[model samples]
Every structure is written in structure tokens, then in C-alpha cells.
Target: MKTNESEYDRLLHDIYETIDNPCAWKDFCSHLRESVGAASVHLFGFDRQRDLFSWSDGFGLANAEPLERIRPLYRDDVRLSWLRAFPAGKWLHCGVELDCADDDDAGGTTGFALYPVADGHRCVALCKLVDHQRLTVILACSAQADDAPLAPAARALLERLTPHLSRAVRLYARRFALNADALAARKRAPAMLVSAQGEVLHSNEPAQQLLRATSLVRVRNRRLALTAPHHARLLEDIAVSEARLRSRANGAQAAAARFRALRIVGEKGEAARDASPDGASSASGQHEVLYAFYNVVVTPDDASAAELRAYAALTFYHPRSAPPVDEKVLAAAFDLSPAECRIALLLAEGLALKEIAAQVGVQHDTVRKQLQSIFQKTATRRQPELLRLLLNLPGGSAGAAPDAG
Candidate 1:
């Protein structure tokens, strides 16, 4: 009994260590898993406002694959309805089956059914609320029998660890907040800051001018409004972008490269007709414009910056008005043939493959073949990704180019 008590105390010590060093969580969870003789131990959190997993880590599982497989369903779990007001330092033990028979919002199986517990597994978990965030820990092991109760000792250990888990997560959250605040200290200009819900918070003079001049984006009801499809994609992208930015290891350049791009097609009929492809094609429209949104963690620098914290920043690229791509640099960097360089330059100028085909007097199929070769050479799979690469290359941004004589 003394040996067991000592092991429990060691596990408790590990929880506290995680507050100062977040990576210490891996060691803690591994220790907890071994101490309890359990199949798995998982500690994870969800940001209710952002609707994304704040963080998830576990032992006896392959990465987060199991959790991610059911993430969509887990987010809408009715059992979590009590999360907002859950008592701190309290725990619950759910047997082999969860209450998942009800219909979710999409008229599909409820989130509980998709949760990680398998048919023969029993679970003991603690759930708590930290501001608008919900954190949980699940300890699962094979059930002795369908109706057998959990070992009393295992249940007691989890209950004992509950308060410590609560404190650890609260302190963990604070560390992230401090990191975000530090990132906000860097000066940014010509950038538009927006909330996760797409509400406009701040924009510099150049940014506002660009927004006003283009039909691609609009401010409606004090929020950035877009076509229904684009708006849905925007929300999805923001959640992903913010989650990646929250990682202490992800730097600005890596985050920017991973940003999802949006295509905003204009409503003008004439513009569409002029750039239309000749034969059967998959191009949505000729007047489509691309915008890449980079997530920015905004901790208000001033009162005018609003009470905003943890928002996103958008950087627009106007290919038409932007300086021409330096073909010499492009050819040198990506090893492009003269013909391929001509195609690449037009692409940088916002011309779709169909439009580029017409402009260069080549068949659509011929242009498509060249594009495939370009994609292979540059190690990109999508049009938006290739464009982002080009627009970030030398002389891509207006400031990177030489002064006009």
C-alpha cells in the first residue's frame, strides 16, 4: 500500500510540473497511464467560442488519430451541454455505453456514439470549465464484465487527481495567453485584423483603401461578408489557422505557408464571358480572385484596437496591379523553361489556365500539360498553393521590387 501511495504522489507531482513546461504533459500522461494499468489516458481541451480543439494529448494511442476521427461528432455532444457550468475538481464515471441514441443538429448519430470508448471499455473522466474553454481527461481500461463496477482504487485515484488537473489546465491556458500577447507586440502595417466570426476590428490606411476599391470583400453589419460558400470556408479556415498559430513551435513563415486560400468570384457577367474557356472545362468562373488569409493573434495594443484579443489578420494580393514577376528570378529559382516562365508570369497575374491558354495562343490541353510540369517542378499540388509560392518569391511583393524609374 505504501508503494502505491508513493506512485500516486509522483503522478501528482508531474501534473504541477506541466504548468511551467507544457511539454511535461507527455511525461505526466505516460506516468498516469502506467500507474493505473489502463489502456489509455487522454487530457484534452476545447475552445467553445472557436469550436476547435485547444489541445489534445494522450498515451497508448497513435498520435491524435482516434480523437480526430470523431472530432466533428464530439464537438456537438449533448453530454457536454453541462460543460459550461461543470463543477471544478469533480469527476464522473461512465460505463461501457454512452447515451448517443438521439439525433444531432444534422439529423445524424449523436456525438456520444462516436466518442472513443469501445464496446468493452469503461471510462472515468473529469470535466471542467476554464472561462469559455472546456477541458477533460478520460482514463479508459477494459471492463472486467458488462455489469462489473470499476476497481474502487482506480476511481479514487482519478478523484484525487481531479483538483490538480483543474489547476494545471488553468495555468496551461495562461502560458498560451502570455505567448500570444508577446506575438502581438510585433509591429504590423497594411494589415486587416478580424475576429474569428469575421467581424472587422482594425485595418490600416492601405488595407482599407484596398478593401474599398475591390468588389471581392465587403463590410456588412460591421462584419466581413462574403458569398455563402466563401463565408463557410472562411470560418473553417479561421478555426484551423488559429489552432496552428496557438502552437508554440509554429513560426510566422510556416504558418503563412500553410494558410488556406479563398477564391472570390465577382458578379460581373462581362468579365466572366471575356475569360471563358473554349471547350469542356472545370474552371468555376473567369473573374475569380484569390485571397490568402493569414491568422494573426491580436492582443490589443491600444484602446482603439478594440477590446480584441486572439483574432486574425488578412494580407491581400492584387495580382493585376502588383509588379510583374521577375522572370529571370522565377526561371533561376524553379528551373523553368522560357515557355514555362511565360505561363508562370501570366498565372502570377491572376490569369486562369483557360485564360492563359487563349492569351498565349495555345490549346487548353497544352497549357494544362505545362501547368502539370510546373506543379511537379515547384512541388505544389494546387493553383492557389503555386500562386502563394510565386507571390512570396523575390520581387513578389511591391516593397520587394526596385523603385520605378
Candidate 2:
């Protein structure tokens, strides 16, 4: 099969366009499906940690029901398990089948059948592990019979598209998380967006004031500089995060290397606190300012105009002034029940299970069960991770969560 250079270029452009304009995803899938002469093409992600499908879009799907139907069957599909063994950027063919088993409680029996084979149609799928916990996939089903094999040229085209598609998906997810983190930290915290090279791209009023009040951070030659002697550690943290972001190497070791918090003193050897919105030191008169770094999304506009292609968010917030975790927002964000939300709030306040149970007037056993449910709902494994997740939520006050601005 002859490959059209212009056609491939357009497809590549469409893939990146989906990062900013998600609705264009359908167009990307449609173009790819037509290019390969396939019946349908799907772009979807799965969160293995949550055991749930994350986001999905497809072209040439007859109706939306199959999308919903596939969700329940995904956990039981052997193809997904088999696809995991293959490396990213490699496409493999598989037949769709569902295996079901009933335990003794439901009359013990193991059953297997070719489910919804649709005349023995076959699919070519490529899986990309976006991170340790998430998997993104592209699947194309042949319009022809199962016996009809995919063309070599089609396979080659897909292989060529793999890296670009993976990058776009990663950027899409990063943009979403960045928006959320920015909204959460922009109001009550002094936050700035800085490039990998330490150039300040953007800084809120609080951040500007904080920079003015203390010598821990300074603008030297139009770049953010950590002047405090102890801040070398923070600078190294930023470098490691940027390296991981640029290299797209988010393995367990890199994730562990991500530094969430550091403490820095003022140049005068006094403790520095984050400046308030009105350009004054925090009213709490906190001793030290806590610095936290996060990998944030680079906007489509900034991606072109900036000297450095990658960036990180630097935030400072006074622990004393940190607002209480909002139960309503917790409920809305994680689908937690009112009871579970209250328990989560208590947990965020650094309460033990027994303390939470006693305070909430619930049995310890009940609190333990609710805590487990909270863990599942939040997709967090431990209490500390849950606390960090709650603290990073996009609302500082009670009632509704703020919009990601």
C-alpha cells in the first residue's frame, strides 16, 4: 500500500489538535479509520488502579450502546490482559471474546463463549502505558471478514503514529490535572509557573509579593533563583521533575523522586511566610514558607512562545492558614457519600480512625469500613496519599468547588 505523505502529516496534526480541542478526537479517529480502510477506530484509556475506564471516543461506532456495553465486559476481556504484555507502539491482532465464571454462591460453574463476535470480526490494537497506573489504547477493527488480514502499510502507518498519539494523550491528561491544581493553589497560595530553565512564565499577585518580601526567591536576570542556601535541594527537585517530564519517564522510581514539599528560610536567616492576596505577610505569622513543586501543563499558546518547552508549578502556602477540607466539594469530586465526606474531612485534619469514629459518633468498625470505601472512591492507597489528594483539591472553601480558571 502506498502511503500519502500529506495524509500522514494531516493525521499527525489532528492527533495533537485533540489535546486542545477534544472534540477533534472523533475527527482523528475517523481519519485514521478511513486511512486504514477499517470499520471502526477507538481511542480510550483505562485506569488499572481504579479498575475502570477513564475516557473514550471512537469513530464508525454504529451507536453509543456498544461503548457502554464494552465497559462491563472490559474487565472480563482476555484481549486486554494479553495486550498488556506487548510494548507500546506495537500493534497486535486479537479476537473479541468474553469469559464468565460463577462461583459456588451463584451455582459454581465456569463458562466461556465467543461474545458479540459480530461475524468473527478481528481487531488490531496498540496499547500504550501512559503511566504505571493508566493504559491508553487505539483499536481498529477490520470491515472485511476475520480471514482478511490488515495491510502491512496500514500497520506501518499506525506504528509511525504511535509516539505522537501517546504524547498527545499524555498532554491531554496533564492539561486537565494542571487546570485543577492551578485553580486549587492560585487563590490561597502564592503560586508561579516556571520553565525548566527557571524562567518565570507567570506568577500570581501573591507570588509576586512573596518574592518581594523575602530573598529566598529572587528574579535574577529574569529568571527565578533560589537564593537561600538550603534551597539547593528545592532547585534539584525542580530539575529532576523537569527531567522526568521532558523524558516522559514516569516509572516508580521517578514517581518516588517527585518532591511534594520543601522548607526554605529567608536570606536574613529568618523564617519566611507566604504573602497574602493584599501583599502582606500571612496573618498567621507562620515561621517558614513551605514550597511545593508540581508538574503542570503547558498551554498551546505558551508551548510556542516560551524558550523552554517544559514547566513546573511552584507554590507556597502557610500551613496555619490552610482552609479546612470542604466536604461538599469532596462529595462532588469523588462521589463520596455525606458520611464518607465527613469522615474524609476528619481524616484530612490528621485524625486517626478511632478519633474520627469517636468524634463522628460512629463505631470504630463502621469508620474503618467507611475509610476503605473512601480509599476506593478516591483511588488512593494510603491515608497520606488521600490527605495529599484532598489538600490538592480545587476548592479552598466550603460549598461548591471553584471552576478551573
For each candidate, give its TM-score against the true structure: 0.44, 0.37
State, as a TM-score between 0 and 1, how close model 1 is to the true structure: 0.44
Pairs that clash in candidate 2: none
Q: List model 1 lDDT by residue over 1-405, tens digit each.
A: 112888888988898988666778778878877765555566665444434344556666544433553344234455454443444454445442322233233223222222444534434433442444333333233322243434567667776777777767766664323222122222222356777788877655545545544556667776877666887676666655555444433473356345555666665431222223663323334555646456555432232223433566676654432345678778888899998999988998889989999999999999999999999999999889999888667542322312212
Clashing pairs in 1: none
Error (Å) of candidate 1 at residue 330 is: 18
Instruction: Give the per-residue Cα lDDT of candidate 2 at 250.
Output: 46
RMSD to native for every prediction? Answer: 15.8, 16.8
Candidates in order have lDDT scores of: 0.57, 0.60
Candidate 2 residue runs with Cα over 4 Å from true position: 1-198, 203-227, 230-262, 266-286, 292-326, 357-405
